[model samples]
Structures are given as structure tokens and as C-alpha cells.
Target: MFCASVEQMKSIDRRAITQYGIPGVVLMENAGRGVVTVIEKSFAVGRGAEVLVVCGVGNNGGDGMVVCRHLLRRGASPRCFLVGKKSRMKGDAKTNLHILEKCGIDVVEIEDRIPRQFTRSLGRSVLVVDALFGTGFRGKLKGCALEVVERINRSRLPVVSIDCPSGLNVDTGCVDGSCVEATATVTMCVPKVGLVFYPGRRWVGELWVVDIGVPEQAIAEEGMLTSLLESHDIHMPPRDPAGHKTTFGWVAIVAGSSGLTGAGAMASLACLRCGAGMATLCLPESLNAALEAKLTEVMTYPLPETDAKTLSLNALELMAPVLKKADVVAVGPGLSTHPETEQLVRSLIEKVDLPMVVDADGLNALSGKLRILRRRKAATILTPHPGEMARLTKMGVPEIMANKPGVATRFAGENRVTTVLKGAPTIIASPKGEVLINSTGSSALATAGSGDVLTGVIAGLLAQGLSSTDAAATGVFLHGLAGDIMAERRTEYGVIATDLLESIPEAIELVLGSERGFFEGGVRRVL
Candidate 1:
């Protein structure tokens, strides 16, 4: 589904109201009702539970006002706290405030100081509805509003924020200052970009996207390119029952050295686990014994090795014939950055005609010579962490991380290759400007050798007739899902790369066997 920025969301809302003829008040009513539904189902609020609705003077506040009316109808007593002066509310918000008063619901307008009664109300409430800000908000909260937000957070009551957490920057996912730590957020129309990205993600606990009468045509007309990858987005082709081993693609992995043989073995094993029909690990001849002993299912090809026990330039000839039989080539896991090895990597990159997933030291070898990516004939996928992407783009790590989607998209567009910028909320960008923000993964994936498993998963998918874009997108999602599964079974701190690899089948099963999509806490019926 498309993840919208503040401007995109505003444009979509405006278009829906103006051209599509959907009333703004009706939209606000839908948003409010949807939030109340989530509250009723998730929190189980009823007559005995009191809801404290903290609202601002904006439309987001209007939505909160509507929520108060809905809660009253549902046999719940909702205390509405208006942070600013009552007269400050205008338009739909003003209308809703009047409607709340007409319904005999209590509306506490806090102008200068927070009333002691409001604090008591917060203490007695079962849930806090935070409708202080919307997507358009920026900067820090100050004055009475700041006090109210801080007090609400300290109250330890479960908060359900409307649209977004009050202090989050919707576009960049940055928190300038004090932001509401919501227990759940009911975003309207579609999920905002910030909620899925980090920093802001920490504050947006459980997320639910609600339909607020915004026409699908209006959102589609905005031409939003960025999207959050959900389980429904994954599409894997069915295997032919009559087909043999050769029916699925063959993957040739050029990785590892004497000491880094484990990296190559992991990548090769991940390929087979991801459904690649055949996988061959081509590494330094000296590491064959160790790799062969470690990997039983994957075939091993010993290449010419240098004195340092890394693949030498002479191995390129042997790899050329191997590439001719392979459907895809994955290079650069565990390969040391020795001068000769770097040279060999550069040569193989330019010479290999097969679709490739280049990662690890392979990215390091191409640091200054990124022009070689533009010269490749077949599809080239560069899987880089922030440090590697920084080296490739000649920018600092912080800069690359701050604007990962932009950096990955720009690099992919300029180099004419697919770019999988690896990090939390991993970004997969196609040369055509299509970008997918992965919605799976956890801190457990921070462990070593995890990226090698990812590289192998992408290569395995590529070998199975997936395009570079689809392969990378699918691989990253499955890799993260595997990590998530591992994190659940074993604690996040204890999860290793092998654990992630072991869970790949279960992850694939979860993706294929189930019809649900990802939510904040776990898989739920798609909203």
C-alpha cells in the first residue's frame, strides 16, 4: 500500500473533498468512528471505563470531539480536555465542540494552566485519546500543551493517537522534542511514512489505518511512489510438478576466503532453503575442505587461490564457465578486501553477464569505481549497509541513513541497477524509480552473517525467475520475517544468523499459508 507524506496526504484529502465530493465533516466523522471502533475492540471500553480525550484546536481535535460523541453513544463517559481556549476552535472542530456541549458531554477547556480536575480525570480514565496534532504538525510542544502531553504520558494510561503522534515529523520520521508515546495510533486513509520508519516507530506502538471516505482514485491520482511492503504484496510463482531440478534456476555464489568460509556457506545454504533448485559455492580452493564439511546439500567449486588463500585473478576463467550454467551469480560475502581480491572482484563484475547480487566486500571493491555498475549488461543488485552505501555514494553514514530511500533511489536511478539499501525498514529501489519500504524485521537481524543470508535469499529468488526488483523486495521481506520468527522463538539477543536461516522455511510458510498482513504487534486480520 502507498505510504504518503504530509503533503501527499493533504493533497489526497483535498482532492477527495473537492473533486470527489466527499464532505470534510463526513471524513472527520469516519475517522473518529474508526478510532472509537479500535478503542472498543482493543481496549474493551464500556460503561465502567472512562476515556480522557485530550484534543487541540485543529481538525485532529475535531476528530477527538466526534470520538467523545461516539463513546457516549456506546455507554461510556468520555471527558474531553481542550488544551487551548474554547473560542480558538474553528470550522469543523468548532462545530464538533458545540455538538459535544449540546449532547451534555463534559468539555474542559484549559487555557493557561492544566486544571486539577483534568489530572483527576486522567487518573480515573482507562484510556487516553491523543488528538493533539495531525500530519501537518512539526517542531516541539510548548506551554500548557506540552504540560498536558507530558502529564498524559506520565499517567501511564494507554494512549490511542489520531492520525499521528503529536510531535513526530511525518516526512523524515524525526522527533524534534517531546512526542506522545502512544499505545496505538489510528491513522486515516493510509499509513503515514513516519509511523513505519524508526524513531517515530518507537512512539507509534500499534498502528491501524482507517478508511475515512477518501476515494481510492484520489490517492492513486496523487502518483505516490513509495509504499510499505505487506505480506499481500509478496507474489511467488508456483513450482511446476512435472519439472525437475533444472526447472528452478541455478545459483552460483562467489564468496568466502580461508577464514571467511562461513559467509559463503551461509549464503549458499540460504539459497537452497529459499527454493533455489541448485546452489554452488565457488570459493578459494584452500577453503573447499572446510566449506564442503560444513555444507552437505550445497555443491562446492574450488577456484584458483592466491598465497593469501583468497580467490585469485586466475579463478575468473573457471568462474566464467560456471556462470554460463548458472541462472544468477551472487558475489562478495566474506571475501576479504585484499588488493588482489578487490581486483578480482572488479574484473568479475565487469565480465560476468548473469544477473548478480553484489554485497559485502564486493561493494567495498566498487567504492570509487561505481561507473562499472552502469556498464553492466544484465541486472545488478547492490546490497549495502549504511557504511557501504556511504562509501559508494561518497557521503557520510549519517547522511545516507537520514535519507535512505532518497539515497537508494538516486543511486539506483543513476547507476541503472536495483539497489537494496540494508538497514531497519530496509529500502529496495529499482532503476525505474519504484521504491518499496520493507515492513518486517527486528533488532535481532543486527547480528553478523545476517546480511549474507539476505544476499543469498535475493539470489535464490532471482534464480527462480524473479526480476531483480521482485527478487530483492521478496528476499528482504522474507529475510526480515525469518529474523522476526527467530526473535520470537529465541530472544532477540540470542538470535544468530543460523537461527534466521533455520526459520526461513517457517517464514515462507507464514507468508504463503496465511492470508494476513503485518501489524504493530503481530499478524492480524487485514484492516
Candidate 2:
């Protein structure tokens, strides 16, 4: 699903109105009707249930007026409260306001201050519809608007916001002050960039995107760069019944050290769990025994080690022949930052022609010289948490976290490699300017060794012949889905990296089986 910024939304709206000849008022009518449909589905509106719709003077208010009309038709009494003066409402909004008055619905106009009666009305109503601001709104909510938002929030009434929450920046997902917390936001056209992001996402609650007659050609012409990753977007090739172990693909995981052997083991294990034909863990010879004991199915390559037990430069020569036989390589989980280890990582990255997924210490190894990533001939995917990304860009973690999509896009475009900026909503950016925001996963994934598992999952997908972009996008989605399953089985607080690994196969099955359902002899089964 495409995610549109405020500008792109505006452009699409304009194109729909002018080029496609779809009237603005028609779009508003469709939006209001769609919202009412959602409302009807969620709550029982007729039989004396009262609804309060608080609206501003813009087109968003027009939508609310239409909602009031629809509610009246359905045997529900809806009271419309205009935050601004009725005279200020113009264009399609004015037309709707006149219609509301013609229909004999109560239209209370509150201009300067919110009347005490408005607060009382909120208490009596079963639901509140917030149409005080649209996607064009920015900055803080002050004066009567502020009081109105706070009063509605304190009332503990369920709110359905139009377009977006009243005070959110539709693009950045930032709120200056006093934003409405809605039970659900009925967004028109495409999902706004802010609704899927944090801070704004919290206020948005459950989001429903309503089609308002916007032409698909109009949206395509806007050339949107960001997309929301869905399960249907992932494409997995059919397995050949005649194929052997090597037919699936081999993944080489170069990771681990003396104390952090678990990282390498978990990564290699995750790779195999995600359907890699074979997984080879190339670690310092000293740590190989421990990993081999833990990982029964994976093969271990004992590489030369330094005094600190991290892989040494001599290990690169040893890895050359192994990498030649592998489809993809996963590096940098728990390989400590010894000078020799960093050198080995740099040399291997520069010399290796195979696709690679670099994470954790591998990212740390390239901290000062991220430019080297640009020189590589093959595809490289960097899976970095905010901290690792900060180091690579020489920016602060706060800055990186604030604008993850922007930062990830810039780095990926510059380095000519796929970048997976891992977080709550992991973002995957391609060198070709496409960005995918992963919608799965939760706080349960905030455990140690989680990222190591993600590195392996992406490597496994890459080994299966997925393009770098598809591999990163699909891997992140599956990793998050597995974490979500683990959270359901075990509470979020108790979930560990191994829980995610164990649920990998189940996650894949869930995605593949999503379309399957029980059917009767000739018709679809109802139960």
C-alpha cells in the first residue's frame, strides 16, 4: 500500500478535481459516507443513541455536516457543533452547512469560547466525531480548540477523527501540542505518512483508509516513493519436489566471538529455520565447538583467530573458498571490535562478490569508512538499529530516530545499497528510491540477539534468489510477524530471540496459509 505525504495527497486531490473532473464536494460526500459506514459497523447508532460532531470551518467540517445528515436519516439524532463561525465556512463546507440547516438538525455555532453546554453535550453523547482540522493543519492547537480537544479527551468519549487527528503534522507525524486522541481515524484517499508512523500513530488509534473517488491515475502521477509493506507484497517461489538440499540455497554466516558465540549460533539457526538449504557458521576456531554443540544442523567453519578470539585477517583467505560456494553471506553479529577484526571485515566486504547482510559489529567495523560500501560490486544490505545508523552517518541517535525514512533513503541512495533501518516500524530503503515501511512486530522484539536473527532471515531470503530489496522487505516483515506470534504465545515481556527463531516456520506458514479456508462441496464455507 502506498503511503502519501501531505504534499502528495494535495497533488492527488488537485488532479482528481481538475484533470479527472471529479468534484470536490463529491469526494467530501464519499469520505463522509465512508466514515459513517465505519461508524455504523463499530457502534449501534439508531434507537436513541446520540452523536456529537465537532467541526471546523474547512472542508473537513463539510464532511461532518454530511455525517450529521446521514445519521438523521438512520433514526439517530446527531448534534453538529461548529468550532468556528458559520459564516466562515465556505466552498463545499458552506453548501453542506446550509443543507444541515435545511434538514432541521441542530447546528450550534461556537466562535470565541467553548460554551459549558458543549462540555455537557459531550457527556451525553455516545460518540464524538472530530473534524476540527484536516491534513493541512500544522502547529499547536491553542485557545478554544485546545480546550475543546482536552475536554473531549477528559470526557473519555470515543472519538472518530476525520482525515487525521486535529493537531498532527501529516508528513512528519509530529505534534506541537494538544492533539486529539481518536478511537479511530477515517483517512480519505491513501494512508497519510504520519498515521503509520510513531507519536502520530499513537494518537491515530486504529486507522481506516476510505476511498473518496480519487482516480488511481492521479495517485500514480504523484510518484509516491514510500509504501506500507503488506503480506501480499511478498512473493515466495514455489518449491521443487525434485530438488535437493543445495537447490534451496546455502547461506554463510560469518559471526560470533568467545563470549558472544550465541549471536552467531542464533543467526545461523534462524537462516536454516527460514528455509535456507544449508547454513555454515564461520567463526573463530575457539568458539566453533560451543556453536557446533548448540547448532546441530548447521556446519561450522573454524577460522583463524586473534589473541582476543575474534576472527583475524588470515581468516579471510580461509573464508574465500567457502563464500565461493555460498549463495549469500551474513556477517557481523557479536564479532567484537578488535583492530584486526575490523580490518578483516573491511577486506572481506571489499573482496567478496557475493550478496551480504551486514549487522551489529559488521556495521561497527565500517563506522568511520561507510563510503567503502559504495565501492562494492555486489548487493549489500545493512540492517542497523538507530545507534548503528547514527554511527554510520556520524549523526546523533535522536536525529536518526526523528527522521528514519529520510535518513535511510539518503544513505541507501548515496551508498548504492539496500538499507534496513530497524526499529518498531522497520524501514527498508532501496538505492533506486523506493522505501517500504514494515507494519509488523512489537515491543516484544526489543530483546538481545533479535537483530542477529533478522540479519540471518534476510540472508536466507537473499540466498533464495530474492532481489536485495525484496529480501530485506520480506525478511523484516517475517521477522516482525514471528515476534508478534511469540508475543501472543508468551507475553511481550518474556519473549527472547530464540522464541522468535522457533516461531519462524510458523510465521511463514501463517503468511502462506492466509489465503486458504475451509470450503463446502460447491460453495464457500461460512463457519
Point to the candidate with the largest lDDT: 1
Q: Could you tell me which 10 consecutive residues in candidate 1 have the lowest summed lDDT?
A: 518-527
CA lDDT of each prediction against the hidden true structure: 0.89, 0.88
- Candidate 2 wrong stretches, greater than 4 Å: 44-46, 515-527
lDDT of 2 by residue, 37-116 (tens): 87887666666788999999999999999999988888787888988789898999999999999999878988788887
Instruction: Provide the clashing-pair count of each candidate structure.
Output: 0, 0
Candidate 1, 1-527: lDDT as tens digits = 88898999999989998998988889988889888888876897878579999999999999999999999999988999998888898988898999999999878888889899898999899999999988888888899888988998898989999989898988888998889999998898888888888878899988888877687789999998899888878867568899887788899999998778889989999998999999999999888988889899999999998899999988998887678899999999999998888999999899888899999999999999988989998999999999999889899998887888899999999999999999888999999999999989989999999999999999999999999999999999999999989898888999999888899999898889756453333112222
The best candidate by TM-score is 1
Error of 1 at 136 (Å): 1.0
Segments of candidate 1 deviating more than 4 angstroms: 516-527
